[model samples]
Target: MGTAAVSIEHLGYRYPRQSNIFTDLNLQIEAGERFGIFGPNGAGKTTLMHCMTGLLSFQQGKLSLFGNDIATNKKETNKLFGFVPQDFSFYQELSPVQNLEFFGAWCGLNKQAIKQRTTELLEILGLADVRNKQVQKFSGGMKRRVNLAIGVIHDPRILFLDEPTVGVDIQTRNAIINYLKELNKSGTTLIYTSHQLSEAEELCNKIALIEAGEIIAHNTLDNLLSEHKEDGLEGLYLNLTGKAYRDGNV
Candidate 1:
């Protein structure tokens, strides 16, 4: 099998003064697979991403990328993936170009290389028209695009997105999804979580349904559909999660 793009074994986590979030969680994403992680609120979907990206530290178990432990390799392993969080992660006061330049430098790109990559990304993300406008003035969709551009400036091999297309117009959403499709076609493995099941169905071939920090079901889209025979991802999701109210923020 191809080297695992992401691997987690016996992983566990908890917050101060609260109950444990994960206990002995295990998961693996193969290279070149567009893997989708799904769960209701409080399911630990975002938490898992944070742990994978080194945003949060776990006291137990192992998390690795390309066989290198993230906790051990730190900087080197970080360079292998990109992240676009659910919230806007760029400097709102800076223009798209300025933000890209600053973040590109943070990613360790040199002057010429940073400048070159910035130009290319701005063009590709359709931000060239307003590259100089301060990001704070842009619409939600526009800002989301800028966030995506900054996230991929270095062209990471594996991209992790937490609701990357949330709160955007349909047109903007389509633009972002299409761009991501092209990127994945070029061989970037994707790890994503989103509420838009239809959108996820369009892009992801493999999926893992998580609840309370544990994976309850994992398989390719076809297999999942065949096994449950639900109408779609949403149907399967509701079937697995049930009809009870979920305060995901908890």
Candidate 2:
């Protein structure tokens, strides 16, 4: 059998002077799967993604990508995955082409490669017309597209997305979703987290529902719905995690 795209065993994490964030967490995601991690505010969904991507340190457990231990092979493992955070990661003053050029270089691409990729992404993501405009002047949907383009600039084998389509028009949302689907079809494993349950249902083939830092449910979307007797992800989520308004930093 081939190695899993991502694997975590006995993971534990907590901030200083706080209660445990999560403990004994374990998960495995195979390649070429659109995997969604869904949870309410402050449920540690983002934190878990951070741990997987090495953005935050964890106190215990092991993380691996494609069978290589992350701790021991941080550089090697890092090259295989890309993270598109919720916030804008590019410099606001830079044009999209300039931003892509800088990030592409950071990702170790040659100048020619960077130019080609920048052109391709701009065209495919509908940013070609505004390629030279500063990102700060773009709309939210345009900014989100820029965020996505940067994340995949290196053409990573595994892509991690946190609230990728949080605030955007339906047209932009559809565009991003369709592009993500294309990435998956081309063999990029996707690990995503979001509060948009309906969108999650549409994008993910596999689902893991987290609550209070614990994975309460994990299965294929169809199997989860059928087994829990819930018609949709929202129903399953509310049924399991409760409908009370969760108060925490999103």
Candidate 3:
């Protein structure tokens, strides 16, 4: 196996008003691995992602991306990852091609390269016909596909997606998941957090079950099943996380 694409050691985080969200978290994701992070709301799933991408600064612990320290080598670490946020926003008036061109330029790709890559990505994501249509006119599924294409246009080695299919129709969700599987098969390391246990079962080779700001379990799907002697991930999740309400006040 190749070197670990992401390594976290004794990582911890906290907000000024809230106590520590994650404590003493250690994880290593190998290259080309499709890893899933499953957690209830407020379990620090997104917080951990921020720390991994160097978006949030933590005083304690170490984080490395592709062997480079994320804290000390921010630029190099960021360049090695592509982030697809849950709530993807783009210019409503611009077409898919235009939006991709702008982001591609920002990534330092030349005009010709940007155009070629945009065309290829749109086609691959089944957005070729709508490439010229304004994003505001597209359906939710189309928009998600466009968002994914933009994220992968630069071809980074690692991809981070936080709930990429939160509120969409079943067909759209399936399409998005299928595309993600293709990306993984083609050698892009994927790390994502999802509430959909069934989808995670289908796509993730390894999973981390986190709750109450701590990781309760982390292992391959087969091992997790064998250890728990459960039939599915949902059973294991409920067994570990419980069914109690985790209500929060804003």
Candidate 4:
């Protein structure tokens, strides 16, 4: 197996008003691996991502990014990963190229490299025409593509994506997935959360099912199916987490 790009051991977290979100969660993702996180709406997937990124503190467990403990060196550790959040938040008035340029600058990329990468990313994401258009006027799919480009501009070794295709169209979704696959093939490790089981099945080599802040299952896709004797991820998810209503105020 390749070296681990990210590692989490005995991770536990809780919110003041909320119950424990995660407990004794242990996971390791190796370089060039594509892993998916699946769970119900209230399964604490986002919370786990926050904890991994060191945006939120956890009571126990250790999280390491690129072999450095996140708790002790959060700033340096965070630099080893790229994050694409569920929501696309950017300067609405800025064009796609301009936004990428600004973020690349913040990431400390040289002007020539930023310009070249921006061009390549825009073309790859099929946003070439809209590269100069203001983000405020773009569609949801377009905005999501731009969000992805920004996340990967610095080319971090590992990537974290939270429901990346949530609001995108089928065409854009496929495009994004293909690009991510290419990145993985080129040595980038990916960890993402998704509600789309089919997408997860096609893109993820392994999966971790989280429910009520705990990992109910973790293994390769085929192993999970064989162990549970389930037809697919959706069936496995229902069997593990159940179909009970999880209605709660967000």
All candidates' lDDT scores? 0.92, 0.93, 0.87, 0.89
After superposition, candidate 3 runs with Cα above 4 Å error: none
Best by lDDT: 2
Give TM-scores for every candidate, taking all chains together and pairing residue i with residue i. Answer: 0.98, 0.98, 0.95, 0.95
Q: How does model 4 score by TM-score?
A: 0.95
For every candidate, C-alpha RMSD to the true structure in Å:
1.0, 1.2, 1.5, 1.4
Clashing pairs in 3: none
* 119-167: candidate 2 lDDT, tens digit per residue: 9999999999999999999999999999999999999999999999989
Off by over 4 Å in 4: 248-250
Which 10 residues in a row give candidate 2 its minimum summed lDDT? 241-250
**How well does candidate 1 match the true structure, expressed as C-alpha RMSD?**
1.0
lDDT at position 24, candidate 2: 91
Off by over 4 Å in 1: 248-250
Q: Candidate 1's residue-wise lDDT over 1-250, tens digit each?
A: 8789999999999877778899899999998899999998889998999999999999899999989899899999989999999999988999999998998888888989888988888898889999999999999999999999988998889999999999999999999999998989888999999999999999899999999888999999999988999869999999998879889653
Tens-digit lDDT string for candidate 3 (68-112): 999899988887888888876578699999999998887677999
Residue 231 displacement in candidate 3 (angstroms): 0.7
